[model samples]
Target: MPVTPGGKASDGTRADAGALAGVEECEEAPDVSLEALGSVATTTDASPGTVVPGSPAGTPAGPVSGTSPDREAAGTGSGRDTPVERLEDPGNSATERGTGRPGVAEKTLEQALPSVLADGPPKVLAELARAPQRSRAVRRDGLRRMGIATGLVALLAVVFCAVQVLRPLPGPALVMTGAPSYTIAGAPLTPAWPGEGEAAVEVEGVGSLGAYGDQKPIPTGSMAKVMTAYVVLQDHPLKNGDDGPVIAVDAQTAKESTAPGESTAVVAEGQRFTERQMLQLMLIPSGNNIARLLSRWDAGSDAAFLGRMSGAARQLGMNDTTYTDPSGLDAGTRSTAVDQIRLARAAMQDPTFSAVVAMPRVTIAGVGQIDNNNTDLVDPGVIGIKTGSTSAAGGNLMWAAQQTVGGSKQLILGVVMAQHSAGASDYGLAKALAVSQKLINQVRKALTCTTVVHRGEVVGYLDDGVGGRAPVVAGADLTVIGWPGQSTQLTLSAPVTGLPHRAKAGTTVGTIALRTGQAAGTEVPVVLQHDMTTPGLSQRIARLR
Candidate 1:
C-alpha cells in the first residue's frame, strides 16, 4: 500500500490512486455509488473466497489477473475467460474490464436505462425535431387537399363565367302608352222598334249602335234550332262544301216528326242523311222535329244536346238566353233580342251555316223541295237568318244584311223580338220586315268613308337631339267608314328620341291609329318622310344648352 512518487504501489505496481480518486469523484453522480466503486477498485487484491461490496452476498471475488477460476480450471487464459465487474468503478481501464461486464465509462446512465426508453435527451431532441417534420407533412397533405378543392371551385367559376359571356342578349322592351277615344259629332242613327219587343243593331267592326226597350228573355218559337245547328256543326264539323258525318233516322225520330203541331221534314225510319243535309232541313224549313233528330244524333240524347245549346249560349255572351229543349217548339226556350243578335253574329261566322240560311229553298231526299220560311230572304240587301213565330213568342227575326255604306260593303246584323200584329191572320213577320228595312236604310245614310290620314302626310316627328326634327308620315291612305260629321281620334305611337343616326325615307317609325265612335280603330304604318341624318358634333354641342 506504500505509494511511490508517481502514486505507484510498493511492489512497483501502479497504485491506481488517481483512478480511485476519479471513481470517488463520480460518487457525486446520481446513478453512481461508493460501494459499487469500492468493489471494482479492490478487485486486484481480492481473494477467490472474499466477498465484494454491493454484489450479492457470498459472490466470490475473481483472481487479480481479472480471470476466473473457470478459466484456470479450463487451463486456458483466452480473452473471453474474464469475470463480471460493477459499472460504477472508474479504477479499471476499459481494456482490464472483462467483455462479460460493462465498464463504468461504457455503461452511462442513458445506456443503463430500460430498453423501451434507452434513447435519452439526444434521441428525444431528434424525435422533437422530427415531430415538426411530421407536423409539416400532415399540414402539407391538408394543404394539398385544400389546394385541389380550391382548384375545382376555380374551374367551376371559370365555366360559369364562360357560359354567361357566351349567352345571347334579349331585345329592348317596348312600352305601350295609351289607346284612343272618340266623340260623335251628330246624333247617332236609331233603329225603328217592332211592337212589344227589343231591337239591337251591331255593325261588323263598329260595335253596337244602340238597343231599344228592355232586353228581357222572351220565348223563341223556332229560333232555338239555330243553336241546335250551331252545336251540331261544332261537334261534327262540316266544311263549306263537305257533306259531314251521316246519321240514321231512327223510329223514334220518325214518330216525333209526325207529332201534331210540330214542324216536320218527312223523315222516314232507317233513312240515313248527311250532317249537312240534316242542317239544311233543320235551318231552312225551320224543322222542329229535324232539330230534335239532329240533337239525338249529335249528342246521343236530347237532354245532353240541350245542355250543349245552353252552354253555347253562355259562351256567345248571350247572358239572357236559355234553352230548355233543342227545338224551339218548347215554349220554355227563351232569348232576348240583344242575345239573339249575338247568336246570329256567331252563327254567320260559319260559312256553311251562312250559306244554308241564305238559301230560298232546299230539296232533301226524304222530303220534297222545302222553301225557306224566312220571307226576309227575298228583300234586297237582306241575307237569310233564322226567323221564329208562335203565339207565345210572337215573332223573332235574327237578320244580317250587306249594305253599301261609304262605298264599302258593311254587314249589318240586327235582331227584332216579340213583335205582334193586331190579328192572328197577319203574323208579325211583315212587321219585323218593315222595321228591319227602315233601320237598314237609316244606317246606310248615316255612314261615310272618310280619309283620316293621306299617304305622305306627317303624323309625328323624330327628334335628332340637335333642334332638328324628322317628320313621320303615313305610308298609305288611311280611310275608315264612320258616321257623318263625327270626330275621329288619331293616336300616334313612335319613339321620341331613339331614332337611328341615319334612316331611310320609307323606314317605318310609328303607327297612326284612327278611331271613329266606339269601334276598334284601324292602324296605318307611319314612315320617315325623308332620310334622317345625324347632326354634326359641333351642332349637337351648340344645342346642348
Candidate 2:
C-alpha cells in the first residue's frame, strides 16, 4: 500500500499519484440496493443531529466521508443523520440484512404478517396501511352519527311525557238537574181557603199552601204597624232579652191616651219605656199613639219614619203595599193578604218582635196593665205577629203558628185581610183572629211528616263515561215537613275539579237540596254510598276538557 500527499492508501501508506484513474482504495457497499428501502422507525443509542428532516428517506442511516460544512450546519452532519419515523410506510432494512438490529415495533408487525408473501412484507404492509385507517374513520363517524340520533329521539320522548303530565284536565259533568222527586208518596195537600175577604197562608220553608179570594190592595188597619215596628227595629235592633234603649213619651202622644175612636197606650208626659216595653205597647196592645211616638222617636219625625216604612215594604217585595200613617189609622194605608203575609213572615223572624207579640198581657211600671188585642195568643200554637183594625181599615191579622210533627217543627204563616166589615176595631180584630187561626189549623193538617230521602237510598248516579257509575245517596234520613202529593226536587253536584278518584263509602261528594217550590227546603248531603273510583291513566288523559 502507498500513501499520497493528501490521501491514504489501503496499507496506511502515502500514495504518490497526482493523476487520476489509478486503482482506487474503495470498499464495496453491502452487495444490495438501499436507496429503494424505507427509512428506519427505531431510535439509536447515540445522540442525533439538532435538526430533523422534513420527510423520511427510503434508506437506512450511515456515515459519509464527503459532506460539506454547509450540510453539517444544516444538521445533515453525516450520512448518519437521524431518520424521521414513518407511520405511513414501514421498513424491513433490518429484516433484509442480518447486520442491523430491527426495532421492537417493526419486528412485531413483520412477525404478524403471512409468510406466503412472494414480494416480501414491506410493500404489502405499505399498501394496506391507508385501507384500515379509512375503515376505522368511517366506523367512528357512523357510531357518532348513531349516538346523536339516539339522543335526539330520547329528548323528544321526554318532552312528550312532560306535555302529557303538565296539561290541564276538566272534571266530570253535572247530572242532577230536573231529576224526579226523591221523596216518598203522600196524599195531596188541599188546605181549604177562607170563605170571606182575601186570605193567603204559607208553610214556612214550603210553598204557599193556598191563595184565596180576590187578591187586591185593601186597608190593613194596625196590621200595617208591623212595618212600622220592623223599620224601627231595623233602625235600632234589639235581640231577645235585650230591653233596648229607653224611649220618652212626649206630651202629644200621652194626650192621645184619652183620644176617642183610637187605641192608645196609657203613657204620662215625660214617661220613658224601654224599647222592648214600647214595642210591647205598640204591638200587643195595638196602640196607635205608641206607633206615632215610635215614628217620631226612631226617625226624628213622623214623615221620615213613614218614608222608611214605605221603602222597607218595597225592599221586601211588597209592591202592593202603600204606607200612609205609621199607626194604620189612615184609611189610605193599604196592603193585600199576600203583602201582609210577606210582612208576617219577615217580622216573625225577629226574636224580639216574636217574643213581644207572643205575650198576651204585660204589666208596666206606670201603666197598671195592658192586654194583647189579638185574643188568639192564648193558644200555644197561635203566635202573635200583629192585629190591626179601624173604622176605615177593616180587620187584618198577620199571624204565625207552629206545630211539631215527627220531631220537626213546621211554621204556618197566614194573613186574613178585609175580614168582616169596616167598623169598630173590636169586631174587626175578632174576625181577623178567628179566620187566621182557622187557616193555620188547615195548614197544620195538610203538613204531613214526610221523608224526602232515606239513608243508603240512591238519590242519583255518577256516570264515569265508560259505562260505569257509583251511587250517590243520602247521608241520613232527610225528614222534611212538606205537603202531600208535592214533588221535592233533588240536586246532586261535585266540585269543578271533578269527583275524587277514590272515596270512602260515606264521602260527601255534593249537597242534595229538596226544593218544594221557589223556596229551598231541607239540604242533606249526598254521599258516595259505594266506594267511588277514578278512571285509568289512559282514560284520564283522554278527558282533557
Q: What local distance difference test score does each model get?
A: 0.67, 0.68
Count backbone clashes in candidate 1.
0
Off by over 4 Å in 2: 1-167, 174-179, 182-186, 421-427, 464-468, 495-498, 517-519, 537-545
Q: What are the per-residue Cα lDDT tens digits for candidate 2 across 86-109?
A: 322355634434436444233222
Q: Candidate 1: where are CA atoms >4 Å away?
A: 1-188, 405-407, 425-427, 463-468, 485-489, 494-502, 516-521, 534-545
Q: For residue 171, what is the lDDT in candidate 1?
A: 20
Provide TM-scores for the models: 0.62, 0.66
TM-score of predicted structure 2 = 0.66
